[model samples]
Target: MKLKRTIIISIFFVLMLCGSVLASPSSNNAKRINSTYISATTEETNIRYINDKFEVAPDKQWTIKFNKEVNPLAINTENVQVLDSKGQAVNITLGLSSDGKHVSINPPASKYISGETYSLIIKKSLSNKLNETLPKEVRMKFTIMKDNSNDTGNNVNPVLYEARQGLDKIYNLVKTDKERALVSALRDGVNTKINNPSATIDVNPLKDQYGNLSSDEKSDFKNAILSNFSIGALFEIKSIFE
Candidate 1:
């Protein structure tokens, strides 16, 4: 009887130990984000990252993506902040992608300053759909390259320079004379507006040029334009043709 009682007690302790092990959370089983990327547009093809920094166009929207789907409710301006070198938060609007794995941050209508360093802060509060927090908080630093035309002085508008560069790229990409002419007209119109803000804008010559391009080409064109121009310049151009 003594041996039987000792055996029963051992069995009870073993069961209890098993229960505890099952109830405890397993660190090895925790889910984590697989990867991340940043882009100037919503298209995945345009996404880019360099050494933990995103080289973004001044006037474009910034899209941040995680390989794992995130909890939409947890994504907000409070959890993601864009700070300048001085650590002041820049005015921005946050938007989530349809898949709930990406967020788009739009700066104030003015766009980011060229040749300036900015930090994108993703706070610890952000979590995946499973309610698991990121392995750690993420802070990414990036710099907007100075506009090519700004070589002479700081007075040149970097956004405008970017717009011109975009137009130049488009011109080089087109093979047909009609497309080239349309791009040239658009480029000329933009240049006129930049050189003389009061000049009467005319985008009518190229109004229909974009209607026939493939979706990929359209995205590429948009990226070029946004990369080269500032929000203000875009607004001025829009006021003419939009």
Candidate 2:
């Protein structure tokens, strides 16, 4: 009777061990995304930004790398989507690498709109070779480069060009040397503030210079500058006087 009871206890432990092994997650189930990027150029790998605000060429190709080998069947257009700023879907073709560990996305021709933002979405239904799905859907945002050419004239962002022209007009309107000097000082202060890493910037110097102008002139000047350049770039011009 003692020997039989001992044998039964051993059998029970063996069954428990087997059950634990079966319940453990498999290697494929542990797989996850290792990295992602836009292949901007032959030598460049533009790493994916957490904020999803990548600036890329109009014809940029996207790539996603997995920590483990994936099932080629898991990658498809239905699992991946590219959406424009307006939330309209952009057509794309999906391809898996030879090892099935990487997926590449080829967006439709002319699908990327210049100066616009886009989102690359990976659905949660995407699974690995073991049929283990991702924990959550992934969404990444990117912006097509406003100007992506080597030609000097064409390479300039249109809004930047317009902003520079507005600055030129402002410079011309400053009739006195003192007023021109104040504008120059303001430009320098703004540029300095932009280059600084600190978030809270003191624009008192620029504000003082701006106070010298008439209220109506100030309003018109502000409108011209803001309309031409995004508020973000208006502070970083190399030469506002030019």
- lDDT per residue as tens, model 1, 5-48: 44433332232122110001112122222234553211123222
In candidate 2, list every pair of residues with a backbone clash.
none
**Cα lDDT of model 2 overall?**
0.49
Candidate 2 residues lying further than 4 Å off, grouped into runs, are 1-49, 148-242
**How well does candidate 1 score on lDDT at residue 70?**
86
Candidate 1, which segments miss by more than 4 Å at Cα?
A: 1-36, 39-55, 148-242
Error of 2 at 127 (Å): 0.4
Score each candidate by Cα lDDT.
0.52, 0.49
**How much is the lDDT of residue 54 in candidate 1?**
25
Q: Give the 10-residue window scoring lowest on summed lDDT in candidate 1.
A: 19-28
After best superposition, candidate 2 residue 231: deviation in angstroms?
14
Q: Pick the candidate with the highest TM-score.
A: 2
